[model samples]
Target: MGVQRLKGKIKLISVFIVCLIITVFPVVTHAMRGDCGYEGGISSGEAPNKSSFEYQEVCFITGEPIVFKGTLKIKKTYKNNIINTTYIYNLDNAEKKATLTRTLNYRTEITEKDNGQITEKTYFQKDPYEVIKIDNVTYTLKNYDFTRSSFIDQKPSINFYSGDIWNKKTYQTGGVNSGRSTVTVEATGNFYGYDQYWGSAETQIINYVISSESVKNGKIDKWTGTAKVTLSLTTTKQLKYEENLPEQSSYKGVYMEKQYNESILEYSCKLPEFDSKGVSTDIIKTKSGSLKIETFPQSQPLSVPDISHLRGHWAENDIRILYSLEIFKGDSSIFNPEQYISRAEFVSAIVEAAKEVPKDPAFEKKNTRTAAARKKKEEEVISPFIDVSTKSEYFASINAAYDRGIVSGDGGRFRPNEPITLADALVILVRSVGLEGMAPGKYPVTTFRDNDLIPYYARQAAFVAQEIGLVKGDTRGYLNPNEKLTKARAAALINNFINYMREGIKKVYTEGIVNYN
Candidate 1:
């Protein structure tokens, strides 16, 4: 959003990557938490499949809440929007003398939205498959499921979430549930969990109200909630001195029992949390602890320019944030802070900041000559708009942004060289992050003196940007939406957007979740 860095004053996520968007504005109303539930994770990673897991589990074996310390081995891959994951959990309860390994085959569907939200649909076309091998055989998991749906405002200052999970793992030999274990693993936020074998005959029914809120702080949202759980586990089946130890060693035995726990469902990250204190840290720590996925975004290099011009400018800090991320690559030292930025330049910068990974979308459609489409499409001199050429330095970002519906051209031509207006920039910025049409009304008014100057099409975007603290009018309270955005002004706007994403979004997601609980 801006060109400068925040000097790490706000703690950015070390491994936060590819999160979702929500266009939530209405106050979310979640019913008071009745029964206890569970949720999310965050973890330190050694490799793609290696992660740490530390959480308190309702252990039937111990008849008390037992802390399960272990590593959740995960291998996740994304194709076309579907994510396939393999989870291998090897856990040991030292205090409770419990040990087990559970493997889960999980999948999720990811859909990107323009309204500042991301939706993940689980078990849509796939079934969750799991296998278990318990040497101690204290219990058996007859059922397991979880739901996780997280939403953050565009300002991203608030994280809104509500979810419920149910389980039916029964004891195999202990005194509760006829010696068959009834075990459940529940989670909250944008998804549902079901097991093919466990859920095929009996459905998992959760009872918490489907409450939604935009708790700009809420009265009912909890990042973690408390509930009473009837847990169970089996004491060792007392096997005596056998006449033949050979046959006894080969014999398999199962036992189970039950216990109830009324405790807060908590998950914390063992990784370095954000710089900000309070609930934000707890959220980050927990989200990071999720045993679901791993993201290691490769960093790119940016050229350093002698931009002494940034000194004393209000946009300096924002510009530095972007600069640290290497958003300004091609430009050199004379970086004009007061000059007008072209539409192409603005689009390119937006695309880069969003990390769209510029690619010409048309190439895939245009090169669809072969039936199998086996031929690799090479980057050619193709352009979406008539005026922009492949040779243009801004071509990739422009094309990529256009393909993603972040920008558009007029009359089949992209006026790349033209100066971008304030109104136009607002539209592009809102669209770039899929934040269009999310304001309270179809057409909203701004607090600017010259609000009438904004074109009819750009009014909604202007309102959204203003509401999200992205657009601030001049000292005279004039929106100046129709005016060409000066370099200094553009720097400020860009920086503001960056703050929304990095600081604001991070704040809500990390800390807001803690509060939501």
Candidate 2:
């Protein structure tokens, strides 16, 4: 709390929840010409975590490159079918030229309809807005209304949304009223969350009318301006196992995600001369910076997860890691590591590992609440599979996977009790990671020995999984795509998938920024 307040500008740092890309220097390296990164660890907290970051960007409002620092504090509380998040920012540019203090309060509501996907709508509240000052201009908030909506199945794919915003502001220079602007914005954007890291980018069309202090001939003197705005927000959350902070534990050392949002508003606008009173000129502004904060761990494993039966097993370590991370769980002492995993089990584990599980509805008031407030939550989804009962133990997970597009029922029946085939399992895993789109429309023969045996539906998934190092041939050099997946093999593959997200995907993100030349 104390260290984060020192950052200098509001025009410099912004939100991570509405973020885009994860391109920055690695921690411990010198700040590069066009990048900035941090080297420290996180602090423990009850809810919203706290952290800060620095970056080098072409200033969106100043039209010049500047190094900037910022701090973002975010707190979330769950309430009836919605998660309300509070974003607090303390921003400062490196040169001490600009600063901003603001709080953004927003709520994302998830409504589980009869459809197969989760529909989310985000709403922002207006009140107690802070001032945003950049150099000579001070932007005082007057009114704001913004909303975004999207649908996601439990995968790492992009969260696409279309939104509309109307924001009113009054500006003053040297404490004197300069103008008032009504800014209208339309946008379609998306957030892509890879495991351990996430990003979102938005390019918006904004039009604003700047009204002067006087009116001429019964008309208020105003100038209409339009611009193209692009904001690139980058961040990746990693669990620190090698840090000097809190020691790693099943109940501690897990870290929440961070956000670094850079706003770059650049366009060519020509002001028209009226009565020869204004000079015709082109104006452009490109201010960019990001705000990222790290908070303490908030989630822990459900229980010790009796891995006693996994002793000397090949997938022992993998299973242990997943259990520690709360990504997978097991039954009692009779751990069947070599047994075939059911479709329901595979889908549930895959979704949980991807971290796309939606929250249940908020608790109702003790007193009789309104019907809307008490709308059903425990029964999150009505099973699309005729074979899956609402009372089945796997009902929630199976329904969730269906909603996320991770799995599908055949002829309206989900064979929950049947073993999941390797081909089917690979498809689910590949889909969960959001790389299924890389599969070519005209498929090529796979390089595996059993290429001829690879099922049609699993061909793409096999290709993608193999390319990403998530799959390798067996001792006999066979993919065995048609075989049922054993719990042991499933754990190994799932662990590999997690590693790919933590290390392989990260390699791409980091190396791309450093070697873009």
**Every candidate's lDDT:** 0.46, 0.51
Tell me the deviation in Å of residue 404 in model 1.
1.6
For 246-348, candidate 2 gives per-residue lDDT tens digits of 5574432332233233333333332333454432223433333332333223332233456766778888867766665666665536768788988888877
Candidate 1, overall lDDT? 0.46
How many clashes in each structure? 73, 22
Model 1 spans with C-alpha error above 4 angstroms: 1-42, 45-63, 77-84, 107-137, 143-167, 175-303, 357-382, 510-517
Show model 2 residue runs off by greater than 4 Å. Answer: 1-302, 325-332, 355-392, 411-413, 442-444, 475-477, 501-517
Candidate 1, after superposition: displacement of residue 93 in Å? 3.2
Candidate 2: residue 60 Cα off by (Å) = 6.8
RMSD of each: 20.4, 14.6
